[model samples]
Structures are given as structure tokens and as C-alpha cells.
Target: MRKDRKNTHLKCCIMEISGRITKDAVTAKVSNDREVVNFSIAINDSYRPKGAEELKKIVTYIDCSYWMGSKMAQWLKKGTVVELFGRIGLNVYNNAEGKALGSLTFHTSNIKILVFPKTENSSSLPAVQKKNTDQDTPDDLPF
Candidate 1:
């Protein structure tokens, strides 16, 4: 809550959500040659209903857009987990068939990388180092 010049209190809607990236981020030039990073995340949630013996799983996918820069797209790969802080918005529009559709959108202001997906190249580094270390002798050490 914040007070404006009129001495009235105002409410701000800011949300934080953490989820796994659904796909690699894409950069697009929207207007005035400005680039925006676009990505989607899947948030997994589960809940148990009353008198239920099992838990029900739910997944919510939110489309995110970051206007700060496009360089962050390189790290925002599929399966990477990130925490985003921003505002949520709902877009309601009519489809080509005249049916109404709605989707959730997040205007991300800040992003924190939580977990990075392991790539084949990254996963092979340790094995290659281990193989080299196994062949090394104490006499090979210059020190």
C-alpha cells in the first residue's frame, strides 16, 4: 500500500511465481525496434480435496514477457526453473471462429534463475576430466 499526493491509500498488485520454463525464450521486435523476451512457464500445484484419499495435481502455464532485455533469453531454456516478480494480466479475445478465449500473461519485471537444465555438453565435462585425471601420475605434477 502506498499513499498518493491526495493522502489516499492505493493498493498495488504485484505477484511472485516460480515455475519451470516450458520452452526456450524467444526474442521479438515489437515496436520502435525494441526487443522483448517472451517465454512460458509451467507451475505445478497439487491439492487434496475434502475426504479424498489422493492428491489432485494441477498445472498452470503463464506466458511471460520481459522488456528489459533480450540477452536473458540465452539462459531461459526449456526445463529451467525461474522465479519471476511482476504483475499478472488476463487477455480475453475472440478467436477466428468467434469463440472467446482467455489466457494469463505475466509482465515480468525481475527474474531469478533457480535451476538450469543440464545439457549434454555440460554433463560430459566431468567425465572427460575424470578420464584425464585417472591417467595422470604423481610424477607428472610440476609442483
Candidate 2:
């Protein structure tokens, strides 16, 4: 039996996710033969209370998929930090062990390279060793 997901807000118009890419972008054509890109990302969230002992933080990993042109698929990579806004999607699949598995994927309408947030955290930006390396993906989510 599969656990029912109470939070079925996959249709949320926009969301801000800041985390490390878990896998390289997988590009494929949708059933309609339309180009689509898919990838997984993990977001880290912890808790810290004042005048308290050690606390554990909740970490969330959301699978992201970009159903767009081929240009977007060619621009995904592991460990790349990105901030995106799009709708959420879910899919069921069978693993090598033949067990039914489910995944939460994000269908982005637009994405951008995170530069700087109100808080100063340079680590969120992509670390490109080469000065002129291109890091923009073909993400076109709704603004």
C-alpha cells in the first residue's frame, strides 16, 4: 500500500526552492512527442531555537521535471543550485527490485540562476571555476 500524500498542492503556481541538484537533468520527449527535462533536487531545512539544546532539522527532497524544449534539458547538472517557480507533479514507477515507487516532481515554468537573496549567502550561487562557462538552462517558468 502507498502512503497517501495529504499535501496535494502540486498545482501551486509558483514556489521558491533553493538546494543542491541531486541528479543530472534527464531529457526526454513526452507522450505527445514534446520535449521534456527531468531532474531531482534536495532542499535542506533545519531548526534552531534560542537557549535550547541540539535540534534536528527537516530535510526535503523534491523531484523536479521541466517539460519544455530541448534547450532546458541540456543545461542541467548535479550540485547546481537553482531557484525555480513552477507547478508540482507526481509519478509512480517500478524500481529494479520491482517495487512500486512514487516521486514528487516539479514542472517548472521558469527558472533563473540565483544571484543574491535579501540575506547574504554566496554559497547558494553556482560555483563555476571557469570564468566564461555558460550555466543558464532553458527554463521558462511563468513570472
Which pairs of residues clash in candidate 1, taking residues 3 or more apart in a chain or in different chains? none
In terms of lDDT, which candidate is strongest?
Answer: 1
In the range 99-129, model 2's lDDT, one tens digit per residue, is 7677777777777755322226644444546
Q: Which stretches of candidate 1 lie over 4 Å from their true place?
A: 1-12, 123-143
lDDT of 2 at 61: 91
Candidate 1's C-alpha lDDT?
0.83
Each model's RMSD to truth, in Å?
Answer: 9.7, 11.3
Which candidate leads in TM-score?
Answer: 1
Error of 2 at 45 (Å): 0.9
TM-score each candidate: 0.75, 0.59
lDDT of 1 by residue, 1-143 (tens): 22121212223577899999999899999988699999999999999999999999999999999999888888888889999999887666666666667778888999999987888766522232335665566756777
For model 2, name the residue pairs that clash: 109-140, 109-141, 110-140, 110-141
